[model samples]
Target chain A: MLKYNFSAGPCVLPQEVFKKAADAVLDFNDLSILEISHRSKDFVQVMEQAQSLAFEHLGLQDKGYKALFLGGGASMQFLMCAYNLLENKAAYLNTGTWSAKAIKEAKMFGEVIEVASSKDSNYNHIPKSYSVPSDVDYFHFQTNNTIFGTQLQETPSVEVPIVCDMSSDIFSRQRDFDKYDLIYAGAQKNMGPAGATLVVVKEEILGKVSRSIPSMLDYKVHISKDSMFNTPPVFPIYVSMLTMQWLKDNGGISWIEELNNKKAGLIYNEIDRNPLFEGFVTDKADRSKMNATFVLKDEAHKDAFDQLWKDAGINGLNGHRSVGGYRASMYNALSVEAVETLVSVMQELERKG
Target chain B: MLKYNFSAGPCVLPQEVFKKAADAVLDFNDLSILEISHRSKDFVQVMEQAQSLAFEHLGLQDKGYKALFLGGGASMQFLMCAYNLLENKAAYLNTGTWSAKAIKEAKMFGEVIEVASSKDSNYNHIPKSYSVPSDVDYFHFQTNNTIFGTQLQETPSVEVPIVCDMSSDIFSRQRDFDKYDLIYAGAQKNMGPAGATLVVVKEEILGKVSRSIPSMLDYKVHISKDSMFNTPPVFPIYVSMLTMQWLKDNGGISWIEELNNKKAGLIYNEIDRNPLFEGFVTDKADRSKMNATFVLKDEAHKDAFDQLWKDAGINGLNGHRSVGGYRASMYNALSVEAVETLVSVMQELERKG
Candidate 1:
């Protein structure tokens, strides 16, 4: 059975990348990627090349950024960024679940000022305005809210260093790289796999925390080792590099963004036109180009609609358990053809009704 | 080519597991594994089954211990264990690089006492005697030294809680589970992949530390969430579960130990009897059954001998750069057939000389 995947993360990846990764899993150039020592020249080259490609993709050459592939997910970075950069206090604008997780981790490290929150409205929209503390070490935000299907259309311009968790939306759009002092994303979403977390940091903001940090958790130690301080998640990073290469070969982020816009537009149009369904978020401007969320207008039809989608060979369209509805995650790798098929299914259901 | 992998960690897995993982990567039960949510009942079942199987394989039923698959590897546990358990001081047995890493992590949390050292012999032998401080929280040691090619024949019987980094030799032997209060291992060597770390800790020993530990780094937090406090390395854990299932089906760790001993004996015998090579570690009792270290008798012939092995489709046999010699890491998944092939290669080299 050929199924189209629309899960928020650990989402779809290019079939070519999967084939390459599977081949390497058994035998990587006759030396399994796992078997090769991290310090070995062959594996070092793999690390260096992965970082180089990431920087190239992000266009971060003289931006004073260090690219590191570390374990733990983007959730860890919320604490890591706070532990490494937050000295006295930090400010966070909570948009969704990921931002909340980040803010919680930040509070453990230092005094965290919740500048603004969308939770009052059940996080149906991104916060409009927030104050950035001049004394605060950094300001943090999530670019896209996976659960609520909302995105901050513009990067928050703050006086302090701005850190972002772009886990679901990174590399899907083109933006000025200089806007963020640090950015991190788990590879499972738009990148590669779940094992590695890709972090790009401004080197100067580190080494200020008074707290004793574990060597593995410390971004500085990873930077010093070139992200090979310990044996890295070799297979994940290698596949990520290949994914980046694929992204590059396919005309980079701008191309992906254009394609993503088309996919999101196709699905959103169907939801808006269909009488039985209505978008959950209710705000058009805040609608995410990555994850499109909708609910049945007649609540009784929800389960039947879900089954209809499942019967149509669509998987992972069910919304997060917390946000009980349907969510179609249109990540960069999700093909336009898949979106077309989903839209057609919705239309056919409407015609039959 | 049928390449034999002898890398200490990120080592070989059963070919069956690899094929299964590969099949899932492309399409897992008709949906790619990456496409599924971790919160899904299917993935949750995977975690439950893996943990249940791991405990069963170790014969750890109703032992007042919890099995957790975590991130940051065993290195993270060094700090986590110390932060959670150490109040005043902890004792450490210095065996090799891994032990040194553990000692370094422990120092950040509290006073760490080095009870014994084999550094005098370049850590080629595990220390025979160590003073355990009854006042300390726990005693720490590495069971098998991967780089130095040595193993502790028997872990020291200590009154305080024992925490061992059994990263390399885990699942290679059967052991009395009662010996240690906590045991942690990175799943790269014998268990599975490079991303997940396996932790087995007594439940009663937690929540005793004064320091405020980060939620993600705290073992208690993981235990509370059933190791799902954060998004886990799901794919790696799944692969680990498959490997655990494989081990269980093959008669568990006791059966694995017999096969391990048989493989180690064959290669060690060949090294001892061959005039063309010599074992690097001096003591007979200290040799590791997992990683065997040897040097060519004639220094000039090292390159030629290495090339000979490489040409024979044997890979990752090079020793750590810190110790310039050859190391054939016969991890648990490595077959006796592979070790017999290695012994034949050594014999052939001797005959050529």
Candidate 2:
């Protein structure tokens, strides 16, 4: 079936990037990238180029910050960050599923102080008034709650280092990168494919924890090896490089932010204006620009609406199993045209009602 | 330029698999697999089918054995196995660099007892003496040493549970699958690609360790979730399934084993017969059937021979920098014609000498 993808993650990638990646799979510089040794100069060049592009495009000039592409995804980083930084009690603001997972991983390594939680409201809104402990090592939060369709407009002002899991909202908007002591994201969502995770860490903050961290799990090991501590997810890093290059070519983060905002605006406006559909997330200000969650007024209409979208070749529009509604994730690579098509469907549904 | 790949691994795969994989990069089932949601039925089906095919082809009827595809490659399994099995000291048979690494990871979790080591022989041979302590939790070994091109012709008889890192020789030949309690291989070598690792383990052996293992690093958690503990390396697993299916379709392990034997025999015969070249491993019985390591008789001819192979479109023929000269990895997917081509080149070098 001919389909337009709006999946939350392992999400859509630019056609151009896909074409280039496909070409490289067969013959990466006349040798299959798959067959190329990770230690070889050719692959080293690939690694360096990708890393350079990522740092360059992000406009990160801080020498203290090291950008690493490592294994085990962002969920792995929750523990890694905690293991590396959380020696004493660490504070976390639980907003949604990912934050809860991060908190769970943190508690495994050290004393985790959940400063605030929106769980009482079913995580429909970002928690306010984080009570950071004076002895806490760092405060952690997910910048965008992927499952709940909520986002922290600005990182919580805290006395300690600010760690953020920017898995869903990374590079979607402009922010002072230096404010975050650490930021990490799984590449499957907005970056590239599923294997690699991007970790940006402040170098000075490491080596504080008194725990014997595994070399593979240690961010310092990756920082020293430049993320070549072991054979990395080479193809994902390569595809991510191409995507970042595409982002730069199309006028960097500023351009992407504008495009993303326009796309999000179109869909949010439609959801607000339509009577048949209701936005699930209570707070409009806290609503994610990446994933927009909504539900039809009549629950019966959900199945029919889903079929309509599926028949129209819209894929991955179903919300997470936990959320139980519709979530159209308009990630960076998702076209504005796709959002427009979805808006048209919503309009058609409203007219029919 | 047409290139022949002989890298120890991230080695060559079937050209057909590469072509099909490349096609899938842009569109899988008319929808880009990259864009497919992990929760979607289509991808779930992919995961189920892959697992089913792997179990079917491995002829694994023992419900106690669970097959899992995970991230972090074989190196991760070193820690995972120790975390799952080790209560006190574990026994290790150090065969090569990889075995040493496994030993190191094991030590971090518990006291690792060196049962045997062949490092005195420059890891040119697999150690024959293996004294698995009755008190030790598990005995570990690398099935095939990629660097030195030596393989264990038979499993070492040990009372303790056996854990093998079969990264380079998993499906190259058929063996009695019931011998080992656990076996794992990084996919880049003999399987499909670099992003995933295949782990086959017995269920009864887990939960014996006393240490608080990280959930991501826990085998029990993964086994409980059927390896869907997190969003997996979906594409890599899918491609691996296709490769496994290909193996099954082409008359299963017996046929592939016969072909692998032929390919290795042709290359080994040429190495032994060619006056200009000498096999590096010294012991004839210790020679690997997968990676055939050799060097030019005259050091002056080394560069010339390398260039000759490169010009003849042979790639990844260079041995690891740690152990330099040449390594022609005859993986299962490598065509017999490629081996014949390599043999012919060896003959031409001998004639030149």
Candidate 3:
């Protein structure tokens, strides 16, 4: 049962991180991680280290941006982002399901303008061009689509503030850390587990919206309280601290970005070169470096490709149910050697075809 | 340091559960618990077993009640309960800080009538007499108050519906589970860690609220999707399952209730007998069996008592900052011997006095 984990979110983490997490579970500094009080000096240090590490990894330190580790996942942020920032209006790019969901949540707070979209082509590409309005409070978009295998390559440079949900692609790439006004990601994809959500927000942008917000939902409250407004998901935050430290030791975001692209490039090259397979993304530039979605050239090869991967000790190669194909998620933990194994499988599939 | 954990929550769990959780983190059936996909067969089974165990422990199986494990803590449920159930009007009994906070959230949805309040006396006791109007849609009350160390001994017999927040005292004792339309707990105090929130709701009570509820906050959406409305707090839920299973093995709520009462009685007896200490609760019956709060007869003995508990290798016995005293939370996991050590410490303090 030793297999490469290809899950999109709640995916694989560094093996050393896993070991440390296990040890902490047994005894977090001699106190069981399960039993550590949230207010204890030991756990408070853990929380503070987790936040600083996240801010360091994101390169947001000393920039008036506070990184918060909250309990709910990215899904909760759909409504929370709007609750904190969507004052009179906002603009959102319709990239995929996450963007659309964000738009839906934002609509309740104010008028939201969909500047551009690629849904007409089943989201095979991230829209290249979009016009943001100056009247809108902020422009929001999803950085990577787990289901569609598309990603925004360029950060949208707009006059207004930019909000991004980097849930599926965070820590996989190094971008202008100071570019956006707000950024949130569910920790499951690249950071650690499914419980904690990482939120980095500029202090100045909050308290601008003309609406009463719940203390938990308000980013200002989280920032002011340093993300301990209430009891948080302690185990998830601890594991994530380990993972962030791993990223730091392993040359930070730029090095991981290079490694990620190397793996993704190998798989995409196989999809393009192989006769029996083709990339699902129409725009090669817009294709995700994290989630590589592709399909068999013909329907007849479905069973063979399926059995081939299963026999090769690959799991989670099946694509999302909404878009049926094969998706190989290449997060930071996925080794290039694993991608080479996948490339070898592609070569085998081609020969059989 | 090897010590007895007396933190309210994230409090101690069974030592066996801690060992099991650590093992699972290392290798959950050949897959690291962190790497297992939420949709994977093994994890799905884990989720299923967790929900069923919670319902069974509550004695609500096949009673049209669906148990849900979601990401947010009990604080989120304060708003979610009102968002789902508050229609025209609701009745609230404000016993302590938690009850008052629940009332604050419920007021945002509809009219809330405070049927009774013990806040006039700093919530030293649960109000014994209150007439719940038959016209209100649902009645909300907290089963146990952690900081104030008060508890509702009798379930409120309301005509419309009953909702309870069992965060601090769930699984410590058993009562008539059929009386309430909804019950929710943050799985940290008597349950497990501080990530997963357990909600058991009557299927028929939802969809009655007129306003739109966020998908993540809607109980019906979570119930229909089986709490997979999003990626759940996997590690916390897993540990909670292990704890609940341990409870079952050790003779469910009734046996734990007996053990809890013994520990509370020992501590209360010490408080009564020893001239150095006095109980905080005005009514003996209203005092929480789980969280036993008391104070030194004189603040002059503070250093001695503090040193005494520390010398006994106890942790988290300090009362909440809001209430400056000491609280020894005797949750299901705290052993009778631990309480015995505390009682001995109190006895030693009296001898010194």
How do the predictions measure up, each by TM-score?
A: 0.96, 0.97, 0.98
Candidate order by DockQ, highest to lowest?
Answer: 3, 2, 1
- Best-fitting candidate, scored by lDDT: 3
lDDT score for candidate 1 against the true structure = 0.84
Please tell me which predicted candidate would have the highest TM-score against the true structure: 3
**How accurate locally is residue B194 in candidate 2, as Cα lDDT from 0 to 100?**
80
**What does DockQ give for each predicted structure?**
0.58, 0.66, 0.75
Instruction: Kindly provide the TM-score of model 2 when superposed on the true structure, using C-alpha atoms.
Output: 0.97
Residues B228-251 of candidate 3 have per-residue lDDT tens digits of 988998888898899999999889
- Candidate 3 residue pairs in backbone clash: none
- Candidate 3, residue B210: how far the Cα is off, in Å: 1.4
User: How many Å off is the CA of A123 in candidate 2?
Assistant: 0.2
Each model's Cα RMSD: 1.8, 1.5, 1.3
Off by over 4 Å in 3: none
Task: Residues B1-353, candidate 1: write the lDDT tens digits.
Answer: 45688876788888888878877777777766755677768889999998898788777878999999987777777777887888889999998887888899888878999998888888877878657989988999888998989988786878999998889988889777677889998989988888889999989899887878778878888999998887788788888999998998988898999999999899899989998888878898999999999888788777778777877778778888767788999988888988887888887777776
Can you write out model 2's per-residue Cα lDDT over A1-353, one digit (the tens) per residue? 45578888889888898899899888887776766778878888878887787677667765688988876778788878888998878999899988888998899877988888999888999877657877789989999988889988875667789898998888788877778899898888878888888998889899888888777878898889988877887777888888888988988889999999999899899999998888989989999999999888888677668777877779888888878789999999888889999999888776765
Q: Is the docking of candidate 2 incorrect, acceptable, medium or high quality?
A: medium
